[model samples]
Target: MLSKKIKKLLNRQVNAEFYASNIYLQMCAWAEAEGLDGAAEFFRGHSLEEREHMDKIFNYMAECGAPVTIEEIPKPPSEYDNLMEVLKAAFKHEKKVTAMIKQIAKTAFEKEDYTTFNFIEWFIAEQHEEEVLFGKVLGKAEMLGFTGEPGQTLHIMDSYLKRLAAAH
Candidate 1:
């Protein structure tokens, strides 16, 4: 059986994941509107991935005999100043999520919930990769200066992102 504290935290994670999905979906919408198809596809994919994350925790809670409560997710912003702005927002969100998951991992360790700990280890690694991935995208956006210009470097970056998105 899971402790109330642990179960509560897990339920909160499910809610957080839902919020993340909404955030990514909003980002995807903005990317599409701004003509960043590659970035749009990337975010679109991540939105689904975040929902999967929520489902994973929900299932884990059931497996642990914990009652699950799905909470209401707040709306995320649908606008950004530019591609750079979008990238910054996403990278910041990823870092925040990494911190959140770290805390959950710590609680799992302290509670000796090895099954939970082991399950969250996957999230820990995934967060790291997510941060790194966003960092790389931010770096590219910074390099290109996305100054609302129509240019070769920007096109190259889009193509790169397309290939990157295709891989995932």
Candidate 2:
């Protein structure tokens, strides 16, 4: 059986994951509108990944016999000033998620809820990879100069992102 507090935390995390999916999808749309198809595809794939993340938690809660409460998905930012801003936002969101996971893990451990803590280990590792990936993207965007329309840097980045998307 799960504690009431952990149940609340997991439910909140579920909502956050859903919001992340929308965030990535919204960013994908913005990238497409800016003529960055590769980036858009990358974000599209990322959005699906977020949904999977949510499902993992939802299923885990169900298995634990805890009521999984899902909240309404919040609207994410639909526009960005530039590619840099978009990348930064992605990293920021991921970082926020990492913090949330860490805090919850701490609570889980304090409660001696090893099952919940063990389940969250995957999220902890995933968040590390996400942060590193997004950080690299931000660095690449800065190197390519993200202010204007399509350029050489964007072309290269598009190809790279396309490959990255294809890998998953």
Q: By summed lDDT, which 10 consecutive residues of candidate 1 come out lowest?
A: 145-154
What are the lDDT figures for the candidates, one per model?
Answer: 0.86, 0.88
TM-score of 1: 0.92
Off by over 4 Å in 2: 145-149
Best by lDDT: 2
Candidate 1: residue 88 Cα off by (Å): 0.7
lDDT of 2 by residue, 1-168 (tens): 889999999999999999999999999999999888988999999999999999999999999998887788888999787666777788999999999999889989999999999999999999999998888877776777755355777688787788878976
Q: What is the TM-score of each candidate against the true structure?
A: 0.92, 0.93
Quote model 2's TM-score: 0.93
Residues 78-156 of candidate 1 have per-residue lDDT tens digits of: 9777666777788899998899899889998999988889999999999999999988887777777665355776676
